[model samples]
Target: MAFMKEFHDLEIQLEDIRSATNNFGDENIIGIGGFGKVYRGSITHSHSKRQIMAAFKRLDRRYGQGDPEFLKEIMMLSRYKHEHLISLLGFCKDDGEKILVYEYASHGSLDRHLSSTSLTWRQRLNICLAAARGISYLHDPNGTQQRVLHRDIKSSNILLDDNLNA
Candidate 1:
């Protein structure tokens, strides 16, 4: 994939990514979706040198989305910054490997909670509002750029923070 100019600063060395993900060990896997498997790992902060949890999405070489879609996602993520959206920390494209790094959603996917326990009326409402706002922000045509259509929307896609705030 030919990365655009915007990818220059966000490019993460494949070695670093590999190290952070412990070579993508099975234990690191947190979820699996249509594109690839998502892993939980910790990378050292650039400035603080402290370990920070991160979600490492390594695209499957054989069955995952193509380079065009991957590149498009990187482009879109690099351009958009919203509070409700997951932050793209960086990406890796090397040795025929494609990987994306994002902020860790501590509480995990919303679906995890739905089946395990009963949510209070208030908690359910908050989850709904947050997901709606995120979708609304992505679909708003009045933004500086064109609206983004999220092809996937489901309980599993709705990540939650440490506080369970969607």
Candidate 2:
């Protein structure tokens, strides 16, 4: 418990998460993956008292991820910061729940827009470039000797914002 104190600012109460996500209601579900379901919700900052839309990834033990994996993800994300990389806003680890809160991508994942006729060629190129940059940063983070390998690299893993940037 003492080790977790380092992340106090990034720790979010489970009650707040439940409230924002309507108790993890089906209506708020945005995506489902191996880890679990991702819900779209809004959480009010404890300090700022400002509400922000976020994506909450609730861990499902049946999916194989547990506390160790959850902690690893939090540590990695907390250490790394890049424009194209998804931002980790906060996390919930109360009541036997492990949830990662991320900045919401209004446009959703890259795979969803791949088949759309509305996606222009330039937009697709830009998305690819942005994703590449993010990957590059992870592989060789600035001023770090450690090389981070993203075992999962897929269109669905790449999220896009309102501007179609990945």
Candidate 3:
């Protein structure tokens, strides 16, 4: 139990170090939430030139649950790897700031399009279709016998690419 406790503390320390090392400029932050603030970051892994946008969630340092919850979400999200799901590129914690990085959608989110009254009906339907397909892909019906339920499906979570497609 002591060993486990030490390991957990070490992990938290490492996360803090990582988060602190990364720049937390206002320009880096893309969105804000009750639990954390997400930032836009570039990740070049193993020299692969992949242009991807990711959101980094920087947790509130005052909350002890931040790191654990962030880690838990990362683990679960990683296991839920799917094209439909926004990928977790990386994470870090700096002095209680737990940041989660994810792929960025160029066209922003479904909410952006909906907020505007100018969208044609056809465009809205197409967006809905793409979002549905993304959802179906995440369900992974072939592997899991248990039905997958999306407890928090929202327009803002639906990402759009540069091509104006979901």
Candidate 4:
């Protein structure tokens, strides 16, 4: 009873905040998609000492309120730890706004590099190998198919770190 009321109140507050936020695509939006806009943010409220950019995805209300895929991804990622996979730092859910906070990649998508004249054949081959290995693990015979489908396979999804490796 009390919890429900609290949740409802929070939902209303979130909607107000969402509405008040700047037009996501106008400036701060680092990425945009059919479901939401990913904005860049700082780590002021978090416990981390090092400052790294974060991807703040605000779910688009036009699609529908709340996103099941986003929730499922966060819920599953919360239970485990891995290197190849991107970690979902946290998620904020409310009546109208659902935000997913993630570590931002500085180099942008692998495709951006691959499409450029600088990407050597060796680098492209390396990326292919890395992605194949990831897909194999996700599609392991013993593992359930739906656990991590890797359904959205694109050069943009592959992120490289400072060392130029996945």
Candidate 5:
């Protein structure tokens, strides 16, 4: 909970997140991974007073990721910034629940569209290039003394926006 003080601006109430995701209903789920399911929802920013679509990653302890992993993710994402990287909007840690909120990727993950015949070769190449740039940034984050190594890299993890930008 000491981290909460350090990331006060990034703290989201559990009540708000639950209300946004409809209490994590199955209908709201957009993706699932080793950690847990990702839910799509609209949340109102406390400061901006504007509603925005977001993806909520609810941590499931049964999946093996605990507090340490969750904290590390928050730390890394909060520190690193890139156009291609998924933006961390905020997080919730209350009532024994751990959740990460992010800007929603309208086009979803690349894996879902890999077999689409409508995708042009140029679009695919652009997506790859953007993802590579993001990876490179992580490996050598600007103005940081540390290097980040993403152990997982897959189509499912490469999200795309409405413009198909990775």
Candidate 6:
């Protein structure tokens, strides 16, 4: 509960997230994993009214981990920022539902592009180095302060942005 204060600005209202994701409709689903399904959505800024793309990860009621794990992830992610890591925009926890909103990676995960012939040798190397830098950032002693270990390190978990940098 104390960590909540650290990310007060990142707490999103359930209703707003619901509206953004079309009530968590299946058609909007972009990915699925052990944790839950991810839906592509857009949120309109209150002041600018500009729509910002976001990926909504709704915790699966049947197989998803408990709220403690969810909060732990939020806390860790909110406290850290890295170019190779997915950006946690906000979170929603209301009425027994839990969801995490993240910056939308248009290119999706690294696994999706492994088979592409367009991937030059240099591009492949860039991806690998980017992922390594991200891991190193988590392990950095002076930077992050805490030695974070990434339990899930797989091609599927390495997301790529629009530029396909990593």
On residues 64-102, what C-alpha lDDT tens digit does candidate 5 reach at each position? Answer: 888998898888888777898998999998999999999
Ranking by lDDT: 2, 5, 6, 1, 3, 4
Give the Cα-based TM-score of candidate 1 against the true structure. Answer: 0.90
State every prediction's TM-score relative to the real structure.
0.90, 0.95, 0.70, 0.70, 0.95, 0.91
lDDT of 2 at 117: 100
Model 2: per-residue Cα lDDT over 30-112, one tens digit each: 99888899999989866678998999999998988788989988888877889999988889888889999998999999999
Native-referenced Cα lDDT, model 6: 0.86
> What overall lDDT goes with each candidate model?
0.83, 0.91, 0.62, 0.60, 0.91, 0.86
Q: For model 4, what is the error of residue 98's alpha carbon versus the real structure, in angstroms, after optimal superposition?
A: 0.1
Model 1 stretches with alpha carbons more than 4 Å out: 1-3, 46-50
- Model 4 scores what on Cα lDDT? 0.60
Off by over 4 Å in 6: 45-49, 141-143
lDDT of 3 at 151: 68
Candidate 4 lDDT over 90-153, as tens digits, reads: 6667554577666666666687787588777887787678767766666662544445666788
Residue 20, model 4: Cα distance from true site in angstroms: 15
Superposition error at 103 for model 3 (Å):
0.6
Q: Mind giving the per-residue lDDT tens digits that candidate 6 earns over 4-88?
A: 8777788789998889888889889999887699999899654356899999988986775878878987988877888887888
TM-score-best of 2 and 3: 2
Better of 1 and 6 by lDDT: 6
How many clashes does each candidate structure show, in the order listed?
Answer: 0, 0, 6, 0, 0, 0
Candidate 3 residue lDDT tens string, 89-148: 655554545666666777777887896787788888988888787678666556753336
Quote the lDDT for 113 in model 3: 86
